[model samples]
Structure formats: C-alpha cells, structure tokens
Target: MTIPEQIEAYLTSQPQAKRTDLRALHALMLQAIPGGKLWFEDGKNSEGKVVSNPSIGYGTRTTTYADGKTKEYYQAGLSANTSGISVYILGIADKAYLAETYGKTLGKATVTGYCIKFKKLADIDVEVLEAAVKDGVGMTGEN
Candidate 1:
C-alpha cells in the first residue's frame, strides 16, 4: 500500500476513541507541516519483528549512525501506543531542548528529548503543541 493508504489503515485499525484522537492529530500534523513528504513505518525490523508502534510521519531527515551509515526518516511523526499517542520530532541536536522549552506548557503531556506524548488530544493545549511542532520543524528542517 501507499504511504497515505498505510497511514489510513493504521489509524483506522485503532480502537474508536484512540482512532478519533489520532486522526485529529494526523490532521494537525499536516497543517503544521504542509506539503511535506509523507511516510509510514510499519514498526518492523529487517527480521520482521515488531519493534515499535507503526507511525505516520511527515517531512524528511537523514539520520547518521555512530557506525557512519545513514538512513532517511521523517522530521515529525505520530503514533498510537498502549497508553497514549506519541509525537516525535527528529533531527534536533539538543537532547534537552524540547522538554525544556515546551514541557510545562504542553499540558498533561510528557515532553522528552524528541517525543511529546499524551493520552488524547483533549488532554493538551493544542495551540501549544502546534507551536512546539513548528519549533521542532524549524530547528531540524533544511533551510
């Protein structure tokens, strides 16, 4: 399936309440980063073991490993996990910036180095989340 199709399938597969929440988040992400490349990760390793929740991603970034190999991934991503939803902001060099800048204002979410997570959209300040997302995109995106 295509990336969009995969994302729809992933979102639709969620439990109804979670699906509604994630769908809203997905739309928010799109509005935050319009025209960005879309991506879908099935959360599988090369061996087909499920390593994480499948994620819908936006934009692009090239990630380099300590071994000097590189891989391409999205700058922002969304996923539904066991407890809640996670929003990932990749490519930021400062590990503490996100949590430090937006944690308190983000409402009930947990702001980590690269992820902001909450049980549902209604639990957080959507505007604050949007600002954080835009901030992350600006910090990590190619100029």
Candidate 2:
C-alpha cells in the first residue's frame, strides 16, 4: 500500500477523526522532511497480519554537517492512535546541544542519544529538525 493509503487506513480506524484531520497530519509529516525516501515494513506476526499493529515506515534524508561530515536520519510515520511521531538521528553524537537549542520549539518533546519524540507534527520546528538531520548525518561517519 502507498504511504497515504497506509496513513488513511490508520486514521479511519481512529475513533471519530475527520478525513481533514488525516489529510492535515499527512501533509505535516511530509512537510517536516525534505528530499527524503519513504519506506514501509509490514507489522505482521508469523501467522497473519496484526490488526492493531499495521506497519512501520518513515522518510529518510542525508546531508552534510557543519563539520564537513555526512550522515543520514529517518523520520517515521505515526500510528493513528499514537500520541506523536518520532524523529531518529540514529548516530547523533551531540544530542544534548541539539536538544537544548531546539527544545524551545519542540515543546514537551523528549530527546535522547539519537531519538526525538514529538506528540504532534506541529510541535516540531522544521528548520531545527533539518539542522538536526544534517548534524546526525555528519556525526554518523557513514558513507
């Protein structure tokens, strides 16, 4: 299934959510990252697909960092019932600086070594996120 379809299926299963809400959520997720690839993984048990856990997928981007380093980071789509979506800078070496600088706009978000979780797309600051992505890519030391 396509990303939008996956997102729609997730939204439809939610209680009393309007179509517009789902559209808005999808748009925000797309707008949060630029020039990224979308990925999907089936969330199924050995026997059959799990009704509640549909799939896991997200977008990924790569860029150069301030220190002339390159890296890649991924942002995942949310389950309809999820309180928020997660932003992962998997090889981030400087989480503290990024968190402190970007936390003001994140509002109630949490940050760890290489993960940032925000409940709503709106809570994230796109520019800061982009910067974080670049930083992560650079620190990763991966080509």
Candidate 3:
C-alpha cells in the first residue's frame, strides 16, 4: 500500500483514544512541515517478523554515520505503544537538546534524546510539543 494508505491503516488500528490523538498529531506535524514527505513503516524486518510498533513518519533527513555511510530517513515520527504514544524528532545533533529544552516544559511527557513520549495528548502541552517538532524540523533543515 501507499504511504498514506499505510498511515491511515496504522492510525485506524489504534485504540479509539489513541487513534484520535494520533490523528491530531498527524495534522499538527503536517502544519509544522507543509508539503513534507510522509512515511509509514509496518515494523517488520527483512524476514517480515514484527520488530517494532508501526509508525507514521514525516519529513526527510540524510544521516551520515562515522563510518561514512549515509541513510535517508524521516525527520519526525509518530507511533502508538501499549502504554502511550511516542513522537520522534530525528536527526538532532545534540543528544541532550530534547530533554534539556523540552523535558520539563512538555508537561507530563518523557523527553529523551530524540523522542517525546506520553500517555495521551491531554497529558501534555500540545503547543510545547509543536515547538519541539518545529525545532526538530528546523534543525534538520527539512522545514
């Protein structure tokens, strides 16, 4: 299926509350990065074994490893987990940025190096989350 179709399917598979939150987040991400690329990963390995939760992704970034290998990946990602939802802001150079900048201000969410996780949208400040996403996109020059 196409990326949009896969994203829709992934959102539709969530519990009602999570589905609603994911949809809202999807819209917010779109607003943050207008015309950004979209992606959906079914969380499968080459063998088709389930390796992670399905994720909906936005924007693009080219990551270069120390070994000089590079990969093009999403700049941001959204996913639903058994306990909550996760927002991934990829390609940040400073590993301490997210936690240092948004960890306390993002309400009840857990802010890590590249991920902001919360149980629900209501548990966090959407505006702060938006700012974090915007910063992430800007940092990657993807916005």
lDDT of 3 by residue, 22-112 (tens): 9999999999878888988899999999999988888889989999999888999999998999999998989999999988888998888
Q: 1 or 3: which has the higher TM-score?
A: 3
- Residues 1-143, model 2: lDDT tens digits: 78667656666665554334445644554554444555544456778866554433346545678999976544444343365555555545465765776667656667766666766655666567656655555554442
RMSD of each: 1.4, 6.9, 1.0
Best by TM-score: 3
lDDT of each: 0.90, 0.55, 0.91
Tell me the RMSD of model 1 versus the true structure.
Answer: 1.4
Candidate 1 lDDT over 1-143, as tens digits, reads 88889998998899999999999989999999988889999999999999988999988888889999998889999999999999998878898998898898889999888999999889999999989888888987542
lDDT of 2: 0.55
Ranking by TM-score: 3, 1, 2
Off by over 4 Å in 3: none
Q: Please say which candidate is ahead in lDDT: 1 or 2.
A: 1
Q: Which stretches of candidate 1 lie over 4 Å from their true place?
A: 66-68
Question: What would the C-alpha RMSD of candidate 2 be, to one decimal place?
Answer: 6.9
For candidate 1, give the lDDT of residue 139: 85
lDDT-wise, the better of 1 and 3 is 3
Query: How many clashes does each candidate structure show, in the order listed?
Result: 0, 3, 0
Quote each prediction's TM-score: 0.94, 0.51, 0.96
